[model samples]
Target: MTESFAAARLPVRLTINPRQRQPPSVDLLAWIHRQPEYRPVVRQAGGGGGRPGFSDAVIIAVLAQGLLPGLFNLLQSWVDQQRTEASIRIQTGDTEVELQVSGRTDSARLLAQATEALRAAREPGPDTARELGAGAAREPGADAVD
Candidate 1:
């Protein structure tokens, strides 16, 4: 089942919100596409939507050949570089999990928590929810990101 599941495509949406005070002057979407790892797996979904003072964009990518962890890390790094906020939401059927980070948030810790939560969600068992709770307790940085 895991093998078959791995072969299936996953749709991940990355919503980027540039800094509220000073929006980035660079082409963030183009920059994201230019990244070595992101070029093949991700693409801008549509034109950005938001009012003048609150600029925001969304990128929808089909993950046909990569681990979620790697993608998560790449996004975290990209957002960190831009000094902005982003939310990565992975939707599988009716279940959706999100990892959100602000400019001041710690990326590594939030990434870890989000990764573990997704893992637990995928492999649901008697102890899965408990495991997620335990994982959350262990990561102090988890509270800062969400």
Candidate 2:
């Protein structure tokens, strides 16, 4: 199953929220479109709870399964460059894997933890529920939300 699975095959949605008092002047959607690597993957801006245009949160379209890995990598790079405190949420079906990242975040750890969280999310077992339940906690780089 893992062999046949492609990043494009896993449907994904990414929401990026900056954890700062003052919103940055940068336009995430526009920034993404400028990147040749990310332009195709970015579907649109997400409104989240409020009007799509009004909210600071920029939500992209649901990702193709095969695109998950690449997008995540791109996001990691983006985080490193921006060095902003932010929350990244990946949602699919009923599972939502969230990461609270800042300039101080450990990139290697963030990737590892996000991968683990995703794995657990995909394969829920007796222990899986506890690992992925609401209020799930983690070290500095990433955070999981049930």
Candidate 3:
């Protein structure tokens, strides 16, 4: 008979952005918590409150590696499209950094590459600049006349 083995799973649930339950920030945070270094643990709120919470370290590490970059890119697009405004807010146990995209640029590829690098803490390849140049060439030029 063949034996079937199941992988061990962590027993914890964390909600990153409770207000925007479907936001990408929440997805990124959940993904980040699964990383080997996150080391999350549930804790009771002080004063014996029934609510459970996560370690500040888990929040910080995820913010540093996952949330900030993806947020900057996502928000950049939103702000450039006049869909939202940039706002940075830091609280006692957490920080939020927001950036506004100044001009018309897709920036999808740049954000993807940046998110991947931050997730792995690795440097991007040298050919990234060449690829960026090629992408820029597809846009309409300032001197083009009808």
Of the candidates shown, which would achieve the greatest lDDT relative to the real structure? 2
- What does candidate 1's lDDT look like per residue over 37-141, in tens digits? 677766665677754654655666655423555565566666677777665555553344555566556656755565456555567566566456445634545
Q: What lDDT tens digits, residue by residue, belong to model 3 across residues 27-82?
A: 33344444434534322223322223312222222233223344445434444444
Q: For every candidate structure, what is the RMSD over all alpha carbons to the true structure, in angstroms?
A: 5.3, 5.1, 14.6
Report, for all candidates in order, the number of backbone clashes.
0, 12, 0
Candidate that scores best on TM-score: 2
lDDT of 1: 0.57
lDDT of model 3 at position 77: 48
Q: What is the C-alpha lDDT of each candidate?
A: 0.57, 0.58, 0.31
Candidate 2: regions farther than 4 A off: 4-8, 23-25, 43-55, 65-70, 124-137, 140-146
- How would you order the candidates by lDDT, starting with the best? 2, 1, 3
Clashing pairs in 1: none
Residue-level lDDT tens digits of model 2 in 92-118:
666677776666555555555555666
TM match of model 1 to true structure: 0.60
- Candidate 3 minimal-lDDT segment of 10 residues: 3-12
